[model samples]
Target: MTSPGRTERLVLPGVLTAEQAAHTVAAIAAEQRPDGAIPWFRGHHLDPWDHVEAAMALDAAGEHTRAEAAYRWLAAHQNSDGSWYAAYADGAADEPTDRGRETNFVAYAAVGVWHHYLATGDDAFLDRMWPTVYAAVEFVLQLQQPGGQIGWKREDPEDGGIDRTEALLTGCSSIHQALRCALAIAEHREEPQPDWELAVGLLGHAIRSHPERFADKSRYSMDWYYPVLGGAVTGAAAKERIEERWDDFVVPGLGVRCVLPNPWVTGGESCELALALWVMGESDRAVEILQWIQHLRAENGLYWTGYVFEDRAVWPEELTTWTAGSLLLAAAALGGDEATTAVFGGERLPVGLEPDCCTQP
Candidate 1:
């Protein structure tokens, strides 16, 4: 854990001082397992995507050694087929509690790897993680639907075999972003993956135009903002998409709601929406959105998962690393850090080839 004023690397400014951001990140760092595994919280579960998000925040804060340890835990635990189990008991990484291998969860490692490489300029580290990134992209693409949408997850063989379920817009959009990072990685290594480019293009088309293939998850905030955040859609179209749902997800003077009718203002969703706004070049609104969530922050710099504004109580009563992670990452983006900005702003990664067959008529 880094004390305030100790990070000589990150240039912290207005929204959160260097001390506050460093302290917030320290709370997340304290939860990293000796084997490098990062659970959601002290007693919560470990999911690959959120674990990688928290690890990326660690990288941004000059905690490179610890960040690599987190990646190493993934490298050490990844299944032979390249995907990790959907969830693991807090620190018991020996086996996943849920054996289902989620495509989005499996694919997120590339985002972390590329972000880390940008932060550190460590070619050897990139070389070391490339196979892990390579295998993960391979695994996620196997479930890509012919229409360009990706199925969510495959049940464990013993329970249901390698069956693909319904696709979720949010998940596919996330995988779209992951594919871009993976392609950038392939580009760096001079390994051509033509199939992946076509897959990305079609996947983007699916997210932008063909909402019919995905489950109706419109009630959730992520399904509203993720396509833009994931680079599947951008520019004026992206602005309109978010503006269309502004009132539905945001709670004035509080934060973004986790779900409608819940009265729960979550830190992660709010920070993510701020991130989306930043990518859309609405930094003013982005800053306002971020400011709305500051009430959710604690003195130690760790953040509560959500608040039941109706009851004036923090509902979950849990301080999640990913919650803290999202805030730090958003701050890094707002502060204009090149690497972190590149990750969130759709700038650093190369967009893959468009598939001829998948475009909407």
Candidate 2:
């Protein structure tokens, strides 16, 4: 792991200094179990999506071995269907707290794996993780609706029965990035996956052109920026989407709101929005967003999950690894970290073949 004064690329003006970045990295590392599972915090539940997220941050901070261990943990605990349970109890022998398997959560392993491979250039690690990525992508694609949107989750753990009544804009947009990363891995190994290409193309179309296909969660900040962040909505459309929701979600001197009509600001959502802004070539605005959220950083370098401005207090009273993880990732992107930039920038990632039946938005 990077020592103090060595996290150069993780240093952003008002976001994280070199020493502060190292401390944050160490804080997240300290929370990881010997078995490599990273829960929300000690005695808290571990979700697969957030687990992958924290691991990606570890990689961004040059903690490659710890990141690899986190990935290995995922490979070991994955269910036979190529998915992981939505939640696992921390310090409870890896028992699942939630039996449901979410498609976006399952697909995120590919994003983390590809990020790690890019950061380390370890072909062996890529080879070891390819099957896991392949299985995960296959599992997620099984839940894809005919309209190119992904169903949120499988409610029945035994039979994998999906509700399929609604797809989430935020979740499907996230899966779009995962699909591209999965395709990149396959392409690296010279393994052609034509089906995945088609799947991704259709998913992108759905995200850009068919907002009506997803559940209506426009009140949340994630739905506003995730399409651009996830690479499904890009170029001029990406800027337009951000502009549409800018006033509704951003809170100026504070951070971003988790939901509208609420004075609550969350570190995770704020940092993610900064990442999306960076993707859209708005680094100045991204830096300012990161700056606004500095008030949420705790003394030990872990960040508070959120702050409720109306109450003028930190809600839930817990510091989270994922929140800190997001901060580091967004800072890395702004500071010109190559791997983080490439992953979020989406310029080099494979765009799966577009279906001729659906016109581009």
Highest lDDT scorer: 2
Q: List ranges where model 1 is wrong by over 4 Å.
A: 3-14, 359-361
lDDT of 1 by residue, 147-207 (tens): 8899999889678657576999999988998999999889999999999999998899889
Candidate 2 structure quality by residue, lDDT tens digits, 1-361: 3597558889888788899999999999999998888989989999999999999999999999999999999999988989999999997588888888899999999999999999999999999999999999999999888899999988864666655547999999999999999999999999999999999999999998989999999999999999999999999999999998898999999999999889999999999999999999999999999999999999988999999998999987999999999999999899888888888999999988778888634
The C-alpha stretches of model 2 lying farther than 4 A from their native spots are 158-160
TM-score computed on alpha carbons, candidate 1: 0.96
Looking at model 1, report the run of 10 residues with the lowest lDDT sum: 6-15
All models: lDDT? Answer: 0.87, 0.92
Q: Would you estimate the TM-scores of all the predictions?
A: 0.96, 0.98
* C-alpha root-mean-square deviation, each candidate: 1.7, 1.3
Query: What TM-score does prediction 2 earn?
Result: 0.98
lDDT of candidate 2 at residue 208, scale 0 to 100: 87
